[model samples]
Target: MTTTLPEAPPAEPGLKAGLKNRHLSMIAIGGVIGAGLFVGSGSGIATAGPGILISYALVGVLVVLVMRMLGEMAAANPTSGSFSAYADRALGRWAGFTIGWLYWFFWVVVLAVEATAGAKILAGWIPAVPQWGWALIVMVVLTASNLVSVSSYGEFEFWFAGIKVVAIAAFIVIGGLAIFGLLPGSDHPASGFSNLTAHGGFLPNGPGAILTGVLMVVFSFMGSEIVTLAAGESADPQGAVTKATNSVIWRIAVFYLGSILIVVSLLRWDDPAILKDGSYVAALSSIGIPHAAQIMNAIVLTSVLSCLNSGLYTASRMAFSLGRRSDAPAAFGRTTDRGVPRSAILASVVFGFVAVAFNYLWPDTVFQFLLNSSGAIALFVWLVICFSQLKMRRIIEREAPEKLVVRMWLYPYLTWATVALITFVLAYMLTDTADGGGRDQVVLSTLVAVGVVVVAVVRQRLGRGAAHDAVTSSKA
Candidate 1:
């Protein structure tokens, strides 16, 4: 029996299958381990105490479910636009245009965030260069790498993600050993798994704090879907998507939950420096690792650079997808000889540079505004994915049952459960306005999302009118 998968709209004709399986695998592994895990976990731990693990678990489950849904779709009909393209097929052009632009907006803003983060670390090491100089240097170097070829970007990310994976794995292993009192040079008698329960009984701040911690760590999981996007450029899109999807369980368990467990166990939840220097660094230092700060600094830099690289790749690809669909300027759909979307890349980079400028001129105000505005976009994209998959599953089953190789568990039940969970999280985010200052992020992101919705509707309406006029002219 021949199996017919749901067909993706044809590509705009320049992308090549230059990415290898190894590159795709490493991207799937490393995409989820962002600088947020190293740096933001510090804040989450401070907020949720040992209960931060619950926060991680909650968000990890959400991410795993979302990725499964995304994998089912991407594997069925892989495209560079990823969920954006899927949204187009499953829902409507309006859904695709809005979500795609929203996602592009998210990553381009993240490019600035990661660039500035990398710059701070570089400037700390080399005081000779100003911070802005370092930012420019980092951005330009990464931009050049991406512009060269898809393989060049892959190679750079391969090493960048390798460092992060190894670092986190080593931290988990060494810290676990230290927790069990097996590692040498352990001066602190207080370190053990007991640290998890000792400091105010694990749920020190109460279970509700877990939700707060969810808000903290959920965004860290944003890049996990990058693999699905990159799978489009791989030699075997369906295979790559399936492999990455299947491995999501271990990746979340080991990278996020395992590492956080080690951190909380190796040091007291109340460790002051964990908030000051970051949880990973504090864990390393607690284990008597000399130059632990510098080592973790290097790892954070690697994470940041990897994020910047992926951010550029993702934003440009989204733009390119939009252009190909005629939602964006047609030039973005055109690719260079190297199969790179130069115009799309440049356009995204332009916004990134503008963000960098905002960071420089108003780090506290305008830049923070941009940060808050795009803060909730990950949740938005996830929400869109959930809805798209719900409709897409039926379409695919009717159009191509063979592509059901990667199916979401429990069908519509779990699917609806996932949707409810995401909606609850968004509603929870809205109520987080009291004294925590999350209101800005929630409100601004909502406004931006609403604005995008309006634009999408207008665009769709205009498109319909244009089609109507063209058909009438032909008849006349």
Candidate 2:
């Protein structure tokens, strides 16, 4: 005898299929390469030495697994809410409400961080504009793009992400050549694979530092899931999601591991320049690339702008998704004639501008508060995806077996293992005050998460009470 699962609720209203396959492709490839990778890997290298490779590999595996689970659900039933919508079906309303808000909060905060980073770069290039002015300009321009139409956002990201991908690919090819002494300007005496072993012998800080390095580099992997979210807006949501999911492994390997390997190989992890100039620029300058700092600054700025553009789009969509479920103001769910969620987009940009103001007015205290509170949200989101998939997989298998276009690698086992791995990371984060900020991030973010969950529960209970009242009155 065969048992059947109950039919899953229909997915929320689908968004415009304005994103083309190319847009989705670039977003998948370029989303993972955040501004953090260009600006922050130096610290990871400084922390883990050549051993940072292992750290990246470990996190890369974790992300690949999480994306696989997310892809499975997304492919089966595409929705703008993405994992949050899946959670609502597979988990409960509270789960959806909590994660959706937290995810929205995370991106709005990111908008400020990327805006400031980009503004600083623009100000340096054209000192006439103040940093805050530049920040306003970028935020307005990107917001307009998003408000215009989904295709406009896609077009902007296509070029923005294109520049970043080209820059990284060029860096890898050129840096690899310089390592083998093939480039004409490969005059840096210290460049080669030897640097990997010569500097502190690769595991300079011992095995524990790899875990520490994970804490440092884990957040850089946040944007990989954006593709899963963007897939909902594509012409072929399932196909786009499946393709993006399959390619995630190579994307992480080539863009992240490949680039970092070049950095450590081109210069010993302990080099002063690596610490001073960041990993990418130091690697370029080592090979005597002229104006290396300027070139890197341009690339980094492109990354920042790409991040800001996507951040707004991602946040608004999440808001719109939340609104559809009565988890937020109903206004957020309505779209303009162009199919843009105008209210949601404007709401997100408004908060983002406020966060940007907080950064400008009190960079140390208020901004850090905002940053720390949202720091661990990426982990929270991944955890939700894992749990949602665990149930979603079973639901799809029983009800709509044909929908499983993108299956998780090993079904229940891998899904559970991914959960355990994420749990371990969160546990380590809580106890490892050695990381200073990591501990605070966990504690503060947990507090914020707990607050949101409490709201979800209250809302759920009140909703139930209202429904009960309506039923009783109808019976009367």
Candidate 3:
């Protein structure tokens, strides 16, 4: 007699395959390009000087390698759980459970942060509304958009991302011209890459600043992996993943590194403008554009909203996938009549609201804690992907190598190198405290990492006990 395995539960219905190729493409482009680049690049540039370009390039290469590994896995088995599911199949149930919860935790925290940030911007534009009120409005609107259907979410993201892409492209083009002294009334005489060496000679803070910059730059690339997650629901998972993986490198190089080059070139490394105003906003304003702050504020608002919308969708789908795998409560796996994971969406949104409440009542304490605690999960998630792909590639090669069309280049060599570099970065982050911000990042990331390890161990023991009980009952 043959022993039979249990059947897997059916995938929840109502998740419409409404997201077209265009939506997935734009989302892949937009998800990686967050408000952080627009707002946070200034600080990196100020610290690293013109050498921040090298910092972005370094982080970009890491992202490219990570995404390629993820694409290889996602193209083979397109699922919402993404790296978590890959970890399960390639590594073990414990790896899956840990990374899934970690990734989920990362996004829910981000939902709160982004919502709060967007609210502040809106509140400034219309002071009649309270900040919390703006937060509520932003959350509700985006939640509804997600609830309508994934297609609706994709459509909204398409336009949101379109605006950002256009803005960045134009900024790059205009800024490039201004740098070359081609713009009207611009007698600055093509800075000719002199800004890079003029101040402290590139790497002024020493090569250590590049390593320090890695911590922030890595986080900026966090959302880029979402493309693989969303691609699973697309009509053509392999094609989508392939295109996204292939193009993302150049995109990062051009948009992120390219824009930073322009900013530092146009303005001195130690200029008060770089410190006082944001990178993009300051660059535009320096060129004598009117209402530059307001214009960039609106763009940043859109980027924040887009991120929030994607956050909700990503968290819900991840929860839904976890439920389907029995790693989470079964309720999360169920869908509404329209195929939406209503419970999952509502659960994630409720947490977002709680975060918002904390932001209002204990702005400095509870909210700040949440932000710090969940800060390092992105690194955890990427590390898991690297390991998963290392294991999964062989399995795929054995079972069906043809499916490995989008394989990670150079296989285990590059994968291991990426892992080593990430480990080094983490180690560096822990030790380097040239700035207060870096020290805080190290402490918070360490705490989050420790918490994830503890959870993984407990979950593993519990799973083993459950398995043992089942075997004993069957024997009886």
Indicate which candidate wins on lDDT. 2
Q: How would you encode candidate 3's per-residue C-alpha lDDT over 183-205 as one tens digit per residue? A: 88755557767877888898888
Error of 2 at 314 (Å): 0.4
Question: What TM-score number comes out for model 2?
Answer: 0.97
Candidate 3 runs further than 4 Å off: 1-14, 185-189, 433-446, 449-453
Residue pairs with backbone overlap in model 2 = none
Better of 1 and 3 by lDDT: 1
Score candidate 3 by TM-score against the native. Answer: 0.94
Using TM-score as the yardstick, the better of models 1 and 3 is: 1
Minimum summed lDDT over a 10-residue window in model 2 is located at: 3-12
What does candidate 1's lDDT look like per residue over 1-476, in tens digits?
A: 97443355566578878899989999999998988999899889988998999999989899999999999999998889999998887778888999999999999999999989999999999989999999999999999998999999999999999999999899888888888888887775645688889879989998999999998889898899999888888889999999999999899999999999988888788889998888988888887899999999999999999999999999999999999998899999999888999999999998999999899999888888888889888988998999999989988898799988899999888888998999898888887885425677778998998998899899889988999999999999
